[model samples]
Structures are given as C-alpha cells and as structure tokens.
Target: MPRSNWVSRVVGWDRPRREQPAWLHGDRQHLLPTHSHTDRHVVSTIPAAQVTKVALKLRHLVESAVPCDLDESEITRAHSSIITPEVVQAAKEAGGSEYRACVVFCLLICKAWFRQQSVVELWDADLHRGREVACEVIAKKLIETEDDTSFLLHNILLQRYSILVDGEPTYPANAIERAVDLHAVDVITSSGYQKCVDHLWRGWLVQDEDNPTTFVDYANRDKISFFTHLDPDRIRVPRYQNATQLLVTIAFLVLFTVAVNTPNPSGRLDVAEVLLYLFTLGFICNEVTKVYKAGYRILGFWNAVNGVLYTLITASFVLRMVGLGQPLDHGHEDPAHHREFYRTLSYNFLAFSAPLFWCRLLLYLDTFRFFGAMLVVLKVMMKESLIFFALLAVVIVGFLQAFIGLDIVDDMAVDEYGVIIKAMANAVMQSPEFDTFGRFSPPFGTLLYYFFTFIVMVILLNVLIALYNSAYEDIYQNADAEFLALFAHKTLQFVRAPDENVYIPPFNLVEIVLIALFGWWMPAGRFEQLNDAVMSCCYAPVMVAAAAYESNVARAIHRNRARGGSGDDYDDVVDHEWERVACAPETQVDFEAEGWDKVCEAAKSDIEVEPAVQEVRQLRAEVEELKRMLAEISRAVGAAAAGEESK
Candidate 1:
C-alpha cells in the first residue's frame, strides 16, 4: 500500500476518510522488505517536492471524494500485479477483523513501524509494517479524508501496542498533547477491547505454574535458540524461580522416647535429651512468630484447634522435664497447670494471627485501603506487631481483673506481697473477681477486654472505610461532572445547610460580649443599609451617577436599536432624544421624555419589539394565524408529494 493513501488510527484525519480506490486492491502485492528501504532520507536537495506532494494530496483529499491525478507507476504496478492469498494470510494473523476493518488495521501497522526506533522499539512495529504494505496494496481504494477523535486515536494506539497493563489502563501519559499537535480529534474506540488488554497484563502467576513440570514445559524448550531466531525474552520466567517448588516437601518430626535404664552421665542428663530440649524451645518460638504473621492465611478450624491442643500436651512434658537436662528439679511441682496455661496462650495467639493474615490478604487486594486501615488502627493504638512483654502484661492484668478484683492489687498484705511474682500467679488463673462476691460484681479489668475488641473491630474499621469512601467520593464526583456541576452541587449544599457554617457553641467568654452588643442594642438592617450608602457615595455625585450610567445606556441602546431598523423610527427617536439632551445646557436634566413616551404609545404596534429577548414571554403568546396557516400548507404539500412518488 502507498503510505500516502493510508489513514493512521494514531494521526487521525480532520474529515471523513474515503475508502481505498478499487483498482489498488484488484490484486495483492508482497510488501518490500527492509532491504528495499533506503538508508538515506527522501530527497534532501528538494525536500519541498515531498512536502508539496503531501500538502497537495491532503488538500485534494479534504476537498474532494475523487482520487488525485498523481500516481507512482512502480508502486502502483507492484500493488496491482500480485496474488490475494498472501494479503488475506497476513490479515488473519493480525486478527480476523483486520481483514474487514482495514482502516484500523492500517493504523496498527503504520504506528508499529513509526514508533519503532529500532527493530521493535516502538512497540507496534510488527503491525505498523503490515499496515504500510496494506496501504500500498490498496492505494486506489484509499479515502481522501476522515474526521478523527483524539480519544479514539489514543485508545486505538494503546490497544494496538500492548495486551497488558498495570494501574489505570489509560492512553500513554503524553497522548493528549500529542493528539492536539497532530489534530486528530474525532476517532472513537470500540468497546470491550480494554478488558482483553488488562487480562493479558497485570495478571498473577498461579501456584500450579510454579511447579517443576509446568516450569520445564514453558521455560525449557529445545526448539528455541538465540542464533536460530529472535524470541520475546521479557515475558519469560527464569530457572531460579523453581526454588518456590520446595514449599510442598514438608514432614513433621514426632516426639521420640528415650531408652529405659540409661544412667550414664555426670549428674544423669543424656546428650539426646539436651539436644531435644533445645530443638523444642526453638520450634515453639518459631511457631509463635510464624503464627503471628500468617494466622489468617491458614484457613482451617482443625489446624487452629490443633495448635492449642498440641501446645498443652507439649508444655506438660516440657515443664515435667524442666530441669531434667540440667541438675535442678526441687520446688517446681505443677507441670499440669503450666500445660493448661500454655494451651490457653496458644489458642489466643492463633486467634490474633488469623485476623492478621486476613488483613494481609485484604492489603494485597487493595493497597490503599489496607494501608490506610492499618495507619488508622495503629495511629489509634500507637504500636504495631506483637511484643512479648506487652502481651504478657495484658494477659496478666486482664485475667487478674476478670477473676480477682482490680483493687486487690492495691490491698496486698505483707505476706501476700512478699513473693510479688507468686501473688500474681494466685489470681493469674483464678483471680478474686472470677468468684462472685454477691449477685454480680465486676472489676474495671473485665470491661477492658470488651472495649479493646470493640475499638479494634468496629471503631477502627469504620474510620478506615470512612477515609477511603471520602477519597473515592472525590474521584467519582470529579469523573462524572465538570467544574460547573461541582459549583452547582456545592451551592446547593450551601443553600440547603446554611447552618453548615458550623454551629460552634458559643464560648462563655465570647457569648458574654456578643450578648451585650446584640441584645437589641443595634439595628443590623439599618447598619447594613447605611454601610452600602456610604460605599456608593464615595463614587460619583448622585446627579452625575445617574447621568453617567443611565444617559450613556439610554443613548447606546437607542443607537443600537436605530441601526437594526431598515428605515427611521429609531433614527427619529435618536435625533429627538439627542436634541433634547443638547437643549439642556445648565440644569442638565433629560428633557422631553417625549420620544420614549411616543415609543411606548406604539407598544401595541407590530413594529415595536422588546429590547430584551425574553423568549419565555414570546413563547407565552399564541401562534399568529398567518404563520400557522403557512406551516399547515407546507406540511400538506410535502405529504401530497410523498403520496404521488409512492404511487
């Protein structure tokens, strides 16, 4: 195809582009390859020749539907003396629609070629080259002009260029200014195409694809080699990524029993027992931290239950053998209580982790909301992430207050306070508040738990959703309406809620002063009127004021009205009025309201018209009989002609 005749979807036209000439597409011609492209630019000595050719062709295309006389025989013959199958084949790979919707197809190919600085640098090179070929092949079938829409041009180019997008899938950032420069402002993008582009890009890799077998099938192919042919490398996954495959290979180690009758050490501790204790300690800590981070992501009831149950069973054995590896097992008598406490701790920790994991998943889906929610809650709570000591403190105070009274800490006896730590242990599980004093008495500590949960879930959640909604509302309103709508909306809000100025409750100090000043002490309406009078008096003297404005407007409108008239009723009024003004030399009073009075006299006459075109007033009158009859006669004639033509 001749490049001159092709219409670019990117550089859209100013008029309706005509179709390609019939002769150009009578047969198909293979596109001349890059070897045929000249290394040098076109004719440097007379660049004017190429420019003039372009200018004239464009002018002719805009003005007329017919093809221009200018013709290049070599290009024309090359386009015509070819087979059709190659053309159809090229069109198919571009997409089946490209064959029929050639205007858009040409755009894709042309843009691809031009945008490419190197082989495929422009991002649309493959398609652009194809369009150039099509243009040459169908030179005779080209349209002269087309009205281009800027939005359409940008959307078309974005669609043709890539199949994937992240964030907003908008036209490339500079599209607006580029379009204004080219002046292609009328093209409309077809619908539903944007979603396909989004799917191709901004998609996540699935777990199955991360597996070893899927990896080798997609990533390792014996057929592809660098020297043999070029391939699209940016989209490929690397070999090291397969390390993610190891998540599936886990096996849990169970508790091992030691051999009986083994009494062979300095104090009697076995090496296996020491190693076993160390491993167990490390595992418990690791589990705690991991659960804290990934609680919600593990979605199973039994998994949660298992953590607590296992912690209880393991803690029993751990406390029973507390000093087994070392040489001290004297006063530590309650392994069972320790087991139960650890179990409760594990269950609570799991509960905390579950929420954290859910929050993480939400953040992954919506970064803005997740982060905003996090900031609000943290801003409210002041810290993030679990700290062991703080959690221990909360648990101690909380259960103590629940069972023992909160004030009991204040009234500890000398013996009871002697072992401060042991005293805490007394109500640590069974505090005094846990036992009913009477019908139902409770300490402040019990209320704290309910309040904490309420603050986290309800209050903090609402704050986050509120901020997000505010941001979203702003964006949504901006997208739907222009400045005028915003102005109207704000004006309506202002009118509807005059109190929205904010009813600041009167400060007692300010209220005293205001009451003294406004308690029927001053006339506010009179004060405002006096203020306006003083402001206007600073301008012209009253006589000149009325004269300056009224005299000028009166003369001007009369003059303007005179100009509109064919003959002289207004001209007479203008002369009569001007003479009266000139006749007043000293007093400078407008004389002879005579002309105006006479004009009003003819108010009933058809010649007189309202100075202001109040359309509503005009529409209020019934249609004149003559005008009504004329319209009816016209419609009758039109109907009769249609009936005659049909017969």
Candidate 2:
C-alpha cells in the first residue's frame, strides 16, 4: 500500500481515542506538508523582488551564523518558493560563500523554519523530491564548507530523521524509523571524536584565571551541568582537596562539640576556642567566594541550608568568645545563672548547626550518583505533591473547624496546635481521642470523625502516594541526566578554589586568618603565578594531556585508515594513560580509543538478522498489514472458512 493510504487508515482511527496518530494533534500538523498558510494573505501582496532581497539577506545572516541572530523570525517568512531548489543549486555550483549560505537556508527550512518539525514530510508529501535534493545539496555544501554547520546538519538529520550519512539505514524516509530517533546529538565525527570530548571537558573545567566579567559568556556556564562528570583530583584548591576538606571540616565540627561538652578547668581558652575562630573564618571566606563566583541567587536548596548552618555555627562561636572571662554583674541576681544562660544559648546553636553540617556530604553526590538521583526523585515528588498536600490541608482544617465549633476539641484535650496534629493522629486511630468520637450529641461527631478519617487517611493519603510514585517513576526514567547535572553543579563550586596555602588539620585555623590578612601581598613573580594557575591543579594538566594524546592517536588512526593502511600499523605506539583509563575498575571506558572495533560491535548488536534489521522490521510490518487486509476482505465478502468445508 502507498504511504498516503496508511496515513488515511491511521487518520480514520483518530476520533477522540487513546494513542491516536500524532498528526491528528495541532502541535504535529507541521509533520504533514499540507500546511495551510493561515497568515499567507498578509504577505501575499509583498513583491517577489522584495522577498528575494530578504531571502538573500537571510542567507548571508545564516552563513555568518551569529548565535543570537539565529533565533530571529524575520528570515522564516522569506522561506517561500523564492528560495527554491534552483537557487540552492546555483548557489552550490557557484561554490563560494553562496554554497554554505544555501545549505544553512535549506536546513532552516527543514528545521527552524517549520519550528523543527519532521523534515521527511517534504519527501512524504512529494514536494518536488525535497528530501533527496536537500540531502544532495547538504552533502555537497558539507564537503565545501567543512564547518560546524555540518555538525548541526548531521545532528538534525540523525536526531530528527534517523538518517546516518555514512552508516546503514540510509535515508529514503520511513515513518517507523523516524519515531525512534529521540536521543540528543552529543557526538558528530567518527575520527577526532576524542578532540570533541576533550573540548567539552576543558570547557566544563571552570578556571580561576577566567575573567569574572566574561566567564559566563566564554564558558557557557549556564547550561545544565548534568552532561560532564567532575574530577576532584583535577579541580581543587592548593591545600584542601575535596575529600580532605570534608574530613577536616568534620574534624573541626567534632572538636567544637568536644570542647563544648568537656569541662574547662580554671576557665582557660582551650583547643575548641581556637578551632571555633578558625572554622568561623574559613566558613565565612568559603561562602563569600561562592557568592562572588556564581551570585547567591544561583545557589541550590542545600546551599541555602548550609548557609544557615554556617551562620548558626558562627554565631555560637562568637557568643562563646564574648561570654568567656566576662563578669556577669550587670542587672543579674546570680552570676551562675547568667553564665548558664549563655552556655545554653551556645549549646543550642551548635546542636541545631550540627545536623546541617551533614549536608556537606551532598557535595560528593557525583561519587554516589544513585543516592543523588534518589534525592532528586524526592525533590520532584515533593514538588508534585504540594497541590495534593494543600487539598488535604483544607479538608483537615475543615474537620478541625467543625470540631472547634462543636466545642468538642477541648473534650479531646486538643489545643490549637494539637487540633491539626492530634486530629491527624485520631484519623489514623492512633490518638486516645479517637475512642471518644461517639460521645458527641446524636451521630454528628461520629459521622464527622469517620468521614474525616476515611477521606484524609485513606483517600487523600493514597492520592498523595500515587502522585509521589508517579514523580519517582519520572525521575527514575531520567535519573542519569539528573544526577549528572547535580555533579556538574557541584564541580562548579570547586572551580574557583582558594589560592591560600593548604590549611593543615589543626593549624589551618591560625593559617586561615594569616592568609586572609597577608596571603595576597605574599605572592611571588610571574613564574609563581603561572605555576599556581597551571601546576597547582594536581590532575587537571594530566587529564588534558591524556585527552590530547588520545586525540592525536585517533587522528593518526583515521589517517592510516584513510590511506588504506591497516589500523594495526599505529597500535604499537601505546598510550599508558588510555590503557589505564580503559582497564580501570570504576572508570567509564572510552569507545574512541577502540575506534572502529566499538563502532563495528555497535553495528553488529543493532542487527536482528544477518541482513538489515530495519528492512526486516519494515517487511514484517508490511506482512502484518497484508494479513490484516486479507482478513478484512474475507469478512467484507461474507466468505465462510475454508477449514470448515475441509472438516
């Protein structure tokens, strides 16, 4: 059957039904080339000469390819027949700037002009072999330009059309093949792919040398952090590594607790007091750096929590220092009581601050991505369940109001706070007041109690559970991306590391204050500054070198393969780092090093039969359609089963 007939059959089934064809929806109407120019009349009177001028200007703009200018919709209107195949063909043959401009224009028509709808629709609708012509022009222009436009074109086609230029399943578009190409375009070229990876890695590594004004612009730091994995060894301050800082901070917190709890003989300044001052100074400095780098608004929920914790810890330390050795005589009956009051205040502050210190563990979420993903899932669940919680709150409040109006809240010994709390407890039959519901006049209280209990405990709670489960499932589906994004953000926090000497365990406190007051002026010459910037980062240079080495090797391999030399010819020049990274127990294996072997394996795995799996799937689909047609014809012709006559 023809493609149109299949669409017609599918269209017939699109009557307010579940799982209807996507074209039935307005959002997907662009997938069909039969688009109604609703606003055509407004532009119809515009002269073709004027339209052509606009089209040529747009072509120049596309060729120049300014990122900000790409979003402008002015050029989209000039995508009429004025910029036809002949124009694109002539532009291609001319082979100057016109070649690249024409390619981008065609891509704009295929992707951006139609709001990124299906490009194959052009061929499906028999729009003058648009798909075939576009592919040829694109390929020719790609050879001529050899620019990043090829990346964009390849991404659009592979992502939107499932059409790989050099690979199998080459294009002559199919509806089923189009449905499955949903993943983002992260890789482009087979050769020098390692260079792409290295570029991405280096770009992600937020540097101290980066200009604060242009950092965001140069780095594209605003993108979702989920794609790049952070390396702690490569991205850390001079003295304090990520794990070391975490451990030392934990030790300081512990010492602070010990100092508070232990009795101080003769009331002398102890280890705890010194530790307190150092921790306070370091915490304040660290937080200030974070705010300066990213601004406070970009800080996460946990960052805010950490801020509160730091404040409490600082206040408690300040209070301890202030109260120490001071005679409590001003308007105080008992000095002991006054001393006890400040002690209690400081203790309370430290106690509240202690639990929040554990939030620092969230920084290492990249190491344990599963737990990070769970936290994300919980966050999503909480966000989704808020409305449900509010609805439940309203119902519970209504029940409480009814109880108070009847003056029965007092009978249950439930106060204002207890009304909300104890009512919920009673709903679950967990409160003593649950048994006294029948004591009300007539059956009003009993009816209300059961109704509230059923609605709140059974119905609403179940609804919340369902909502949470749905959210968790959604998060789980995209857990990898979510977790990676978290890791990426966490890595950014480490980018702007302190230049001060590494704070040694107990001595770091005194050193912190010294560094604050004097470290800036204590700097050496240009060599020292360069050393601090480049060599101070322990693993960063090594990582970059490894990537560079791999990229070179990849280029060499590609060069050899291109010249018809065996890939084995270049295998003798072994990369130790590549081997280490590949063989490591925990590290992700890079497919680039393996090159064509990985690609061949992937291609083999994609095969369902020894021949083309796509062809097999397509044939199977057609056979099923034929079977369905035969059955329908038999039913319509009122034919008896041949098996019955044989029997």
Candidate 3:
C-alpha cells in the first residue's frame, strides 16, 4: 500500500481498533528502508541506493556542474540549488514516492544549510532567517507526518557520514555537531523546536520487544521528576531509576565500610565480606554489560573510575582468597608473618578504594540541578585540562632529558630522575626547590630550573587557569540549556544499552542467571512476561507510588481541562515571558487586557521597544511632511499677490 493511503486508512474510524500500528507503537522495522548487510546498523529510513540517486538528481539541478564541497562557498550554492522548485520536483520523482522524497530532500537541504553556516559567515540576516525558517518548516512537517520522522531525525542526530572512506555522499557527522559548529545550540534547544529534541530522545529510547537486546531505553519518561506522575507499568522513569541506583550505591558503600572495619583475622569470610563480594560482582557485571552494549563509548572518565575501583576490589578479593588457600606454618620460619602480610595487602587495596566509591556518588547525584550543572562544568574543564597536560608532558620530557644529561658522573648520591621530578612538581605547585638542582650541574642547572619554573608556573599554569575560567563562563552563561543537554545526555546513557527489563546492579546478576537458564529455549513473549513479573516484584513499592502519583496527575489534568485551562498553560506562559525578554520580537502578536501591564513594562525595555520606536519615527516623518506642505502654500500665495499688483 502507498504510504499516504496507509496513513489515511490508519486515521479512519471505520477501521477496526485492534493493536496500534507498528510505527505508532515505536516499532520502526517496516517503516525503515532495507539496507545491505554491511550497513544494517544505519538508522536512515532512506535506502543507501536512493540516497545516491537523489544526490545525482540534485547535482543535475545545480547550474554549476562542480562537485559540492561543504568547506568552500559551494555549500551556499548547493543549499540554494537543492531548495529550488525544479530540483525538489526532480528529487521527488527520483525518490519513487513523493512524501518520502520530500522528507529526505528536506533533510539533505538542512544538512547542507548546517554545513554552510559552519564554513561561511552569516552576515545576511534575511538569508539566515530564511534558511532557519526552512529548517523550522521541515521540522514542523516531520512532526505532522509522525510516521517515519523519528527514524529520519534520529539518522541526522546520531549517524556519522563519510564520503571518501565509505563511498557515500558527504554529510555532517550528526545534527548535534553541526549545530555546535554553527554556534546554534539555542536554536536546536529552543522551545519552538523542542518536539524535534523529543523525537530524537524517543528514537534513542526505542526498545525492541521481539528480539530483546541489552540496548533498551532505560530512562524513558514523559516527565522528569522525583515525585512526578507516571503510568503504573512505566517503571523505567528517570527519577525512579536514579533513586534505585542511588539506594543501591549507598547500600554498597555501607556494606564496604562494614566489611572493611570488621576483623577477619581467622581467614574466614564474614557476612559483610560475603555480601560486599556479591555486590562487587554485581557492579562488575553491570559495568561489563554496559561496556559490551555501548562498546568504546562507555570508556569515559566516570567509567574509567569504575574500572579502577572494580580492579582494586577484585584484586583485594583475590589476595584474600590466596591468603586463605596458603598452608599453615607447620614449623616453618614465620607462617603468621606471611599470612599477615597478604591480609594487610588486601585490606590496603580495599581501603584505598574508599575515596573512589565515594566519588562515584556524583554519578547518581547528577540528576539534581546543582550536581548536574557542576558536573557539566567539571566535564568541560577536564576536557580543557587535556591541552594543559599535553603541553606539560612535553615540558617534563625536555626537562627530564636536560637534567639526566647534566648528571654525568652517575652521581650515586640520590635518585637523580626522582629528585628532578620532585623539584619540577614542586615548581608547578608554586614552591620551586632551587637549591635541589644546584648539585646536578652548578649555575647552568640552576638557571635551567629557574626558566622551567617561569615557563610552567607563569605561562602554562596561567593558560590552564584561563581555559578553566572560559569553560566555566561558557556553561554558566547558558546554564539552563547546558543543564538540559546534560540531562538529555544522562538520560541517553541509561537507554543506550537496550535492556528490555531493567535489573539494577546486584539484581542484574539474577537476571543473567535466569536468562542463561531459560532465555535460550523459552518463547520471547514468555520470557518478557517472566522479566516483567520479576521487575514488578522487585520494584513493587516504587511502582505503587508511581501509580498513585499518576492517578492524581490524571485527575488534575481532567480538572484543569474542565475549567477551560490547558494542561500546558503554565508552561506556555513561562515560555512566552522568557521569549519576550530573550528572543527577537515576533512579527505578529496578540495583546490581552490582562497582560497590558506586562506589555507596557516590556515597551519600556530595550529588547521589546523596537516596534514602538519604529512607529514613533514614522509619526515624526508625517509631522515634517505637513510642515513642508504649509510652507509651499505660503510661498505660492505670496507669488500670486505680487502678480496681481503688477497687473
């Protein structure tokens, strides 16, 4: 059936209401175009073959036959050329279907415009606004279609494109990068385009039920709140999930403390030690599952921290086990000493990991506004510090080589490299050890040390400070948007690993065992039922709270609607006030009597007075015109009187 006909049929009331359409329910397999085995993971709804065909058709429509290049001025020409009516028509013809073609064409044009804005200076406000309007229209149409737009938008947001390496047409890596490159974060995150972001969020959250994989939307929610309403069945809400994780983390930390503090001198595992081991194993499994699901993407700073903590705990466990396995002294030199040594080593490793586990609390705490904002700043500053570290490495290497070269006698006094490193580190900390370098090579070594101090302390340290400040200012200046982006990113992390059933930490160990035992032979539906039952049982308390909250919210929504108030009225009002103060004035506005005070106040402000100023200038011009007319009439009268006298 044709796509349009299918849409029409789906909309009609005559059609029997059975299960919702696959597209509507978030199953996109039938909607997405087929791809070759090699390109199976590509999220694009348009076929690869169709992409090439459309590219050819678009190339023919351009006046200049030169190949399109985003880096050069050709991007503007390509954008203009593709949006032309003739080219759009040709693209539609080549697409084998009008609706699909138009959507794909719009995406291609948007991609071009995004690229053009990045490379070219957008001094032309009209041109820029026109392109922006085009993008807005494209986004609007996608939302209206509501069939395959989610998949298409996801393609633009998540997929990377490479022409030379992949033998495909050139395109931006992803919409996010393109927006960032053009310094248009606000445009993408603006309320007018929030539906687009939501669509992208939904796409990221898609979980296939038939063939359940680890990659499932873990943090899917209609609203984000600790006490927000949600369907009873919806246990994967962000706040609830975070709450569960936070509880588990706290439990794990408490267990670790108890286990570490209790004496285990008899080489036997205590209750706390046994429970800690199980929790550690669960956490290890969780990290492994995430790494397997997300691959290299999971190897971030926090994950690295997790890796270190796990390694320490695992080593500690192994050492304890080894010590337990060792035979008694049996008249040997000192069996007690050997066993004590191993025990001490194991405890030391576990004790050292305490700080790391505490720091891990930040991971779950980031859902809060204060922590989320701080995390973003810290993340940015950490990225900035890489440059500082890279330069510092070079300086250290040069200085190390110099100091080593100076130690010609094979000193045999103090560890030469250690002393030099210690001195340099001290200098970086603003406490240079000038006297330490004197023994190496007299005045030359001392002078070199002084120079090193100046370069690192004065230059490199200051540069690092500036980078940190810039990063802090950039994030704080647009704090809300940055936090939203962070929240979205956090939400994405939970869902990136598509687990049909969420098993928080130690619980996941049970899931693994259950899956191993029955998942292979059981029917998918039965397996899902089993998982759902397990989740409900485990998360019964939270689910009950969620159901109660949802019922209340539903009642509130109905009440508001009955009172002739929209559920979103408050949000709309807030958005309107924010836009009035921060955004450019709209061409058309509806003024209400109740809002007259606000309008008057706004008119007095610099941002909202543009229209009023223009009106005032027009009135002044009218007054000048009347004055000129009166003077002309007076001169004419004088001339007529002179003519009469002469006659």
Candidate 4:
C-alpha cells in the first residue's frame, strides 16, 4: 500500500476492512434476527448541494430586485420578501441537525454578498443593507434558539473550508473571515454572537446537575465557579476576569515598589520582600502556563513585553538573594564594597524594569472600547513599520559597505564603521554629519554622504510616513469594524484553549498545589466538588457582588416588561441625531436616478450583440443542413449509376 493510504488508514480516515463474523455466515445470517433503526432518534441532515442551490436562488432574487443604486426602503422590502419567517422556519424544520440548515442558509447569503462587494467597482449600499437584514434575522433566530444553535454559530460557521471556484480550490476562509473582509462588524459583534460566546465560556467548567458522576467534556476544573449551582448563568464574565487581573497586576507592582524602597540594614528579609517574592513566583507560573497553553501565540508583541518584564524581575530577585548571602565583612581593604556591588546591580535591574511594568497596564486596559480601538491602530502601525525597517536595514548595510571600501586608505587612524553608522542614523533622524565624511575620502565620500542623507531623509522617511497614513486612514474609515474585530478576537482568546482553566495569577499558585495533590488520582466528580468548595471560599466576595448585579438587572428587565417599556432606557437624543446625520440623503448619492441610463444603454448593447451571435449560429445550422441534403443526393445518384452498370 502507498504511504498516504497507510497513513490515512492509521488515522481512521480510511476505515480498515473488518473480517466477517461467524454469525453472518450463510445459514447463521438467515436464522439471525435484524433490528431496524427509527428516524425518531436520528437527526435529519440537509445536503450541502441543496443548501447551496437555495442560497443561490435567494441571492439572485435579492440581486435582481435591488440593484446597487436602490434606496434603503426598497432594499429592505426585497430582502424581507425573500427571507421571510416562513422560509427560515421551513429551513430550520428541514434540518434536525444541531447546526440548523437555516443558519447555513444565512451564512451562505452573507458570503455571496461579501464576494460581490469584493468584485464590484463600486460597493452597493442596497446590497450591504440586504446583508445587514439577513444578519439581523440570523441574530434573532440565534437568540431565540440560544444554546441549541451553538454548534453552527461557534463551530460550523467558524470552520474554514477550501471551496472550489471555477474548478480550482480557493483560499480557505470561515464566516468570521468573510465578515471581517466585508467590514461587517455588525455580525460578529451582534448580541447573538456575544451571547453564543458567553454560553461557550460559561460551559467551559460545568457540572452535571442530575448525574454528578458523569464526565463533562471540555470541562476545566480550574475554572470551577463559586456558584456551580447556577452553572452557566453565574459563571465569571471575561470582562470581570480582566478587571480582576488588572487589580492583581496593580497589587504586584505596588508590592515590588515597597519591597525595593524599604531599607534592610541587617540584610534580613522583610514582609514586603516576602510578599513580592510570592507574587513574582505566581506571575512566573502564570506566564509559563500561558505559554504552555497558547504555544506559538504567546510570542506576540504584548507577550514579548511580558516575557522581558518577568525575566528582569526574576534576575533582580536572584541578584538580591546572592547579595544578601554575602558576608558583610571581608579581609579586603574595602569590606562592604563587595556586597554593595551586588545590591547595586540588583537595584539597577529592578529600577530599569519600572517603565515596562507601567506599560503592561495597557494589556488589561484594552477591555475598554477606547483603549481597544487605539491598540488596534497601534498594532497595525507596528506591522506596517516592519516594511520600512526591512528596507532601511538593507539601505544601511549597503551604505556601510561603501563607506568601509572608501576608507581602506586610512585604516588605522579613524573608526570608519562607527562614523558611517552614526552618520546614517543621524541622517534618518533628520540630522546629517557631512563634515566627518568629507575629510576621510574627500569628494566621493561627501557625495556618497549626501546621497545617503537624501535617500534616508527624503525617500525612506516619506515612504514610512505614507505607509503609516494609509494604515491609519483605512482603520479610521472602518473604525467600528476594526474595533469590533479586535473585540471579537480578544473574546475568542479566552475560550480558544478550552482545556486551560481560568486561574488568575496569585490564585494560580494555590491551584498548582491542589493539582499536584488531587488532580492526578481523584475521580472526576470528587475533583470537581473539591474545586467548587475551594473557589467558593476564595472568591466569595466577587461571586456575591456578581450575583447581586445579575439579580438587579433581571428585576429591572422584568419590571420594564410588565410596564410595557423597553428594558433599556439609556438612549440619548444626541446619538439618535448623529445617526440621522450620518445616513441623511444629502450625504448619499441617488445612483438609481443618475446611473439608470448608463445601465439601460449597456443592457441594450448586450441585447443587440446577443441576437447577432444567435444569427451566426443560425446560419451555421443552415449550412450544415444544406451539406446533409447534398450528401443524400450524391449517395442516391451513386446508387442509380451502380444499378444501370449492372443492367
């Protein structure tokens, strides 16, 4: 067998052949009874081809009725007429699968709209509106179904497939990628999607209420909530988790500051120092676990910052320990200097890392919309700057080599390499040192230096500026989409590694001990029970506060519903007016009126050319008919001649 086939068999992609059983032998098989399976327990699945066909028909209907120039009202009407509640319900009923056919239908329609937007010269607002309506309908359905529709929203919709287009496989992209590409932030950030994510996060660590002994897949014992009775409802929110992490980080920073600044004449460990040591150990453990869980993803920019921060702190602590262990008096002339040297080095390392600690606060602060959006812009800019830096590096290396070659005449007197590097760097900073280069190689050196300055200052600098501006403009133009994408990405990060539980730093230190003692040998039920008891005690205050807030919100919603009012009352007239201004008629073009004639002219031309092509085909058919008649005549004449000759 081929290696590929063998590997496939090993992985069970190609099922291995099974030997026939004795019971299935001719006589035995006839005597044995057979059982029939019922459809009642089996889920009905709609074929992918049928779903795609229905989606295409729906797409054609929307496209034909609502052109790019159609008004919002007309577009809404067209979408509403096609994607009616009846149609959605029928699709849902047809598929008894966990990933309902209706969701797949909506996703396909959205994907079609996205593809159109990418291919067209001008984006159709009406098409966009149609997509938005479809998304709204999807959101409504998802919310109504709640956890039941989770498989489609969280798994199937997000699964990438290599779809063939025009007989070749195209790049794989999931629903999230399509939405991001189309700048349809409304879909990913929809209340429905958020609720789905929350459901997934909450279920990350859950217990079986009825059967405690039954093991729950994807359950994390570390994330066991204080109130497991409430299960998902009272599970810790990601935002709350971030907030708690921020508090812990702040506490860690404060402890470090106090520990370093406090005097220790006797070289004995103080309370602050011990507490700081514990915090550092917890942070180190947390980072290690994150790296272990996240793998290569922990190599991102922020994680690099964290790695550096922790490295410095760990080294500083080590140096401090060594310094404390040194004897106060020695046989040397300056006895105290030896110990002071180590202490000074340790303090230097700790002080040097203060800026990084402050910078790390931004990581947690990103939960806020303003900070999150700004971080997205910053991340884009950093990625864009890589291009600039790569080009600059090549330019600098080329110039350095040229300068070195020119300085071969006077090798001993001057450090040509250092001079050239400083000159190039200064030129990049808009400050040129032309005089130093002029004395070394005379005219050629001066000329080269001038060229370098112009290239660095005028050309490369402007290119970098242009790149930054382009990135900034692109992000700001679709600011909402960019922010929502960032938000969704952040939200997914929490639940991506389902096995890694939520043990915020210092608490993780405690979790480490418990895992070692009980995690290995204990039964799943007993282990979960242990985690629940520990979490309830450790997070009593937080759980109580969260429960109270939830109760208040629930009561408010119920009261509003009873009074016939919308649950939310935080709407502002200013926001409403702003939305109106944004979508006003004056701000938009009436493409239907302006471009209708052009469309008609193009259609007429196509119509004219189509008939001419038809005529050519018709003439070809006539010629073929004439040839056939001639062949028949020739055959008949040949037959007659043959008969005459025989007579």
Query: What is the TM-score of candidate 4?
Result: 0.60
Q: Residue-wise lDDT of candidate 1 within 1-647, one digit each (tens)?
A: 01221222112221122222121221111011011112111121212233223323332322232122223332224323231334333332332332222333233323223334225444644333333333323322221111232223223222112111122121111111121122111111112122211111211111122221110112212122322212112111111111111110111121123311232233333564444344434444434533433233322333344355445435534543442343343345765334334433433433344333333223222113344344334322332222333554675565445434434643432233233345344433333232222221344434543443454345544554565555455544433222222222222211111110111111112222332444234464553344334323322232233334334434554564555532111223244666666656774644355466665666754432333434545664444665788899999999999999999
Better of 1 and 2 by lDDT: 2
Scored by CA lDDT, what does every candidate get? 0.30, 0.44, 0.58, 0.57
Candidate 3: misplaced stretches above 4 Å? 1-184, 192-233, 328-337, 566-620, 623-647
Q: Could you tell me the lDDT of residue 63 within candidate 2?
A: 42
Off by over 4 Å in 1: 1-249, 252-410, 413-632, 635-647
lDDT of 3 by residue, 1-647 (tens): 11223223122222222221221111111111111121234333444445555544443443232223322232223234334444444434544553243333434444454335534654543444444444433333333433553444444343433222146433223333333333344434544234444433423234344322212333333243444433323555555676678888998999999978976877678898888889989988777754443345336788788899999999999988888876655466876556666777889999999999899989888867889889889889999999999999999889878888877554633465678788889998999999887877677788889889999999999999999999999999978777766665555444333334678888887777766666656776787778778887877777777656545544554555665555432232223555545444653344575687687877774543356687898899999998899999999999999999999
- Model 2: per-residue lDDT, tens digit, 448-556? 7878887877788788889898988887876775665544334323332222233333433444444344444444354234333433353354345434444555565
Would you estimate the TM-scores of all the predictions?
0.20, 0.46, 0.67, 0.60
Could you tell me the TM-score of candidate 2?
A: 0.46
- The order by descending lDDT is 3, 4, 2, 1
Output the better candidate (2/4) by lDDT.
Answer: 4
> What's the distance in Å from true for residue 187, model 3?
3.9
List pairs with backbone clashes in candidate 4: none
Ranking by TM-score: 3, 4, 2, 1
Give per-candidate clash totals: 43, 3, 7, 0
lDDT of 2 at 26: 11
